[model samples]
Target: MAKWKLYWVESDGYEDCFVVAKNSRSARSVEANMNGFDISDATAIRVMDIPDIFEEKADKKFRDWSKIHAPQQANNPDLHEWPWYADKWLLEELGAQFRVIDNEEQILLRDIVYAKKPTGEWYTYSIGARAIYERNKDLPQYDNYDNEPRIDISKQLYTAMGLALTQCHEIEFLFSNSFVFAVSEKQKKKYKTFNDFFKGWEKKTLGGLFSAMQEAFDIDPEVKMALDLFLDMRNTLVHGITTTERYDINTDWGQKELLAFLDLFLSLCDPIKDIATSCFEVSIEIANTYLLKESDENIPIKSSNELLSLFINCFKLKSMN
Candidate 1:
């Protein structure tokens, strides 16, 4: 039997409670029996195991064991507070075990995992959620030696492809939008309206946009090289995958080629980060030089600045673990 520490919100605030039971359902049932109320809502009940040290204390009950380690209120140090239990108590001691009682939450906590690159950056995935669900739900256990590597590699390949494509799109959008602001009034007048101009430029291919940007700004050779390589791989992955027989999963040689491509895609992470950082810097420079100089009533300018800020924030979040 496990000593399950359960938490829920009451009429006023959070209720910090616990029960000793065989599993999560029984634990909730035990709590409901003692308190004379149903508490079986999976969404409301957060569960964790009471550490063995406290559970083994024969002299104290489960509630008493919890109170012994609960956080004290600021106004009265002697009074233990229930509201801080979720954030303070569990996070400080049993952080890993803390999760809501739901299948989705369980899958997120169990299936998703992160890996830190040598550069101290982190990336995560749910180990191919769709593929795992379609192939076999139990495959996520990752204990089958024969199938694990193939699934793991395939998932990583798809994940890397997604990251590459997303970053490339962002780069293209940033440069294309910034180009609109940087161009002279005469150049802008070629289009019927601002929307038309923006849409026309936005429709340009990644290579075409980069080429246009080169006319105005000195492109970093390394950044250009990395992006060009990414565009090439993106084409092969997106277009060639449907047309060519180069990536046949049924053949050993094609399988080797696919695995090699996965390795190459994974290797682009450092360069991709560098190029993204460069694009962000250039976009900021363009905004500061032209967009921000426009009158306050210029709605497009204001919207562009807001979009840039949001992109920066999102990039920061992804860059962190």
Candidate 2:
């Protein structure tokens, strides 16, 4: 058997799919069947023979498990519902939505829009740009005109940090209460005029909030550090860029520091993702599974709570594979 890597374009963007087939002909057959196209006429489909990295990494583990579980797999049809099997099935089901693209081709946002358009809109736009340029080739081009100010957080690292923190907070919030409380008898006495006293406990910054959380609850040190670094990096970005309230992603060290911060952020947040996934399995999975019908269509999440819960479930489901 040969392994093949398939690169396909979809509505969201690009995806890489791997499959195992008996031969070149068998791979083409599988690809054709996956897209519901006539095998002889499917021009968009492409496949490259490659070694399967997953099998290469987990060969021994899979072999050991299969020795004991192969019989059970044959006996139980619902074994397909397991994460590995389910993910493969889901990818196959979604195959019809993707058209094969050349692996070497760098797909731009415009390429996706062009592929989706029914008419030759892409050609028209290209022709128009060429015409204007051809007529005014002597026009002086200015460099970096009215460009947005550059900053460390404004680049790719900022986006990664944002997403990582968002993921971390999804788990953190479940155990954290947003509201403040008085811990001491003296503080509780402020209940006589609670309205003015409550403001005293409000955290001013993300660091302050996490610090307060640490004081009130048994927070993991790693989790606290993650929160602190995220806020500190953010503040660095802000002060480094703007005068008012803003967090800068880059410290004084430049791109190297930005990368270092991003590395630290991911390392800190990775285990929290695992923890959150575990919590989601225990707290949200069964109830949310029945909320939406099991179908191929993209269903709208009806509320913030439902969306948040479903988002974590997706993370949990993804981690299972």
Candidate 3:
């Protein structure tokens, strides 16, 4: 009994319509029944779940309760205008990569999920698209940005990526202070940032951090390289040194470039997000375990063993790798 909403437009731009149904397929069926044609004939049809909390971040029209059952509901707002729902779901379904840039007030998402269709079209559900909409919402050129985004999505993508990684590095430095070796009083005088504080302890470089991560977690070396490359890409983007040339993605050289980009992007994002999420989950688990440890008189295991077991189960998959 999950509610759903459908959005559709005529092939020739003659009409547009919306419908509510129990699920996606039924929405299509509803469209067919109204149009006097087979469901297969419906053009530009899309179906999305109308969850109960849709109004929190989305428009009211997206809820299935906005159905036109009476005259009062006839002039209800357009469900297609609902923000962020379709793009978020579509990107998620396409295996979009997300990086968390944690901060004191809130967490930010850095998405590097730019993939192309076989026909050389860029997928629009990306941080780049979201950025474009936010910056140019008042501009005439960006009126239909969600449906038809900027010609070069990669440009905005790299910019978003640069900022995302910069913030993520700051976040890492913030959370990693307790784990890093303590610096001597003399060496501590040289520390300006959290990164300096950590690096000062063992005279380590960024490469050292990568090496330690690889040894401890068996993460791939290529992932470290990709992280290094993001800094370079960020610099190029900020300095306006990024170059572009005409190249169809269907061409062999273009295909190679596309594949290489996707591989590197995913390599950098997937493992880092996994580790960060696991750290958050394990912290919560331990906080709960601490309460249980204090309350129970008949503790089967020591507190240290309980914490180890909690971390072990939390990262069982990583251990398997």
Number of the predicted model whose TM-score against the real structure is largest? 1
Cα TM-score of candidate 3 = 0.26
Model 2 is weakest, by summed lDDT over 10 consecutive residues, at 105-114
RMSD to truth, every model:
18.7, 24.0, 19.2
Highest lDDT scorer: 1
TM-score of each: 0.38, 0.26, 0.26
Off by over 4 Å in 2: 1-155, 161-177, 180-203, 218-231, 241-253, 270-321
Model 2, total clashes: 8
After TM-score superposition, what is the CA distance of residue 146 in candidate 2 from its true location, in Å? 36
lDDT (Cα, 0-100) at 109 in candidate 3: 20
- Candidate 3, lDDT over the whole model: 0.40
Which ranges of candidate 1 are over 4 A from the true structure? 1-156, 180-196, 292-321
After best superposition, candidate 1 residue 183: deviation in angstroms?
Answer: 4.3
lDDT of 1 by residue, 1-321 (tens): 444453332211222233334455655554455456666432234444455454333223334655565424223434332222233233334422222221222112223322333443333333333324433555454433213343325455557557666765665555566543324344446677656767777787766765555544444556567667876876677665522444554533234345556446546645565444445564556556655546543333333454455344333211111
Over 165-283, each residue of candidate 3 has an lDDT whose tens digit, in order, gives 66556534422432222223333455776556655534544344434344334334454455466545434333433232212243322222333343344444544544434443454
- Clashes (N, CA, C under 3 Å) per candidate: 0, 8, 0
